[model samples]
Target: MSDTYAARAWLAAADPDPAHAELWLTYTGVALMPLGTNWSAVRVQERQGLRVASLNGPAIHDGPARAVYFLVPTEADWPGGMGELLGGPSCWLGVPAPERVEPPGIYWLTPPDGSGLLVDPVALLAALCEDGADR
Candidate 1:
């Protein structure tokens, strides 16, 4: 069988810092791709209109589930950090993926005021970290 883990879809958040990200991964049973490897291994997105209640698994393709959502830090309107984002039935933070860990998948984006079109993480990383951006 494939080496993928089976899990219900859900939004997960890292502390956006090295130490907290590490601890979050460990305590939640999610696998870490190592320090310098996170760029290529872990998927990240800005944010979107994903309904938090419907997340059940990865999307039909190599991307995020339709119901998954994320917070973006690069937006000029971004409230600075996740702490400023609102959490509710559709958005959340610090929660681990539902069931088990799996290979990194697509991450969807959301805006700062919790509005607007989603930003692609790949594009954001490329513009921001030109030196080590993932393809």
Candidate 2:
């Protein structure tokens, strides 16, 4: 199977009903770094010179909430002590089906591209700090 297809399947497996477009609880293979606010999350994306759809890795946005979750490798060290790092066997993340990119519920802000690319922690921290300093 193609990488994209495999990646899609892997994510879809997380959903109890892969046939339906809905959010499901799944244990993430990656560590989830949640930004405190959507505003800051967007700022970090902008700093990376990437549009929402062009983010290097998968990111999830909680509906009507200030939170955004950036997916990074599970083995990655914490990102400079910035955000809370949630991962490991005990952590469960709400993941939307691979096809759920639009709103009405939790969705992918940036879907995985199958290359397993992830957001750089150092860059994320730098962007966040820059945004904070600008305030």
Candidate 3:
């Protein structure tokens, strides 16, 4: 499962000063990965798309979907602290994976800009954190 997740993003502090605990945590993962962006501060875009299957209880798999977006800042917030979010649908954020082991489509929060937050897949069953914990 871990090996199934190859693509990733790693965010880091714009400055060299002591970064916030939260910021450091983000950089630890998102700062060292490749991404696609024209004008932005920092973001976590889904490269492998998403999987929405009612049979599997709606999961985030390494497959393709109809619509793929981002969790950018609003128009007014664009190029600002948060860098105006445009796509990266929030539904894929904390889907029993990202934010936490909840379930299919459910996003309750969106952190700040220049922050590190993305999604991946664990094909192997044994690698799942909340395997039988659901049933």
Model 2 deviation from the true structure expressed as Cα RMSD, one decimal place: 7.7
By TM-score, the better pick of 1 and 2 is 2
Q: Model 1 RMSD to the real structure? A: 14.0
Q: Sort by TM-score, best first: what order?
A: 2, 1, 3
TM-score per prediction, in order, is 0.24, 0.61, 0.18
Write candidate 3's Cα lDDT for 47-124 as tens digits: 312211211211232223222233222221333222113332221121111332222333212222222333222221
Sort order, lDDT high to low:
2, 1, 3
lDDT per model, in order? 0.29, 0.51, 0.25
- Residues 34-91 of candidate 2 have per-residue lDDT tens digits of 2221111322232232323344667776655546667665555665444556654455
Please state the error at residue 104 of candidate 3 in Å. 10
Cα lDDT tens digits for candidate 1, 35-122: 1111111222322222221222221112334233333333223322221333323432333333333335532122111122233444
Worst 10 residues of 2 by lDDT: 31-40
On lDDT, the leading prediction is 2
| Candidate no. 1 TM-score | 0.24
Where model 3 places Cα greater than 4 Å from the true spot, the runs are 1-10, 14-18, 21-135
What overall lDDT, based on C-alpha atoms, would model 1 receive against the true structure?
A: 0.29
Which regions of candidate 2 are displaced past 4 Å?
1-4, 12-55, 79-81
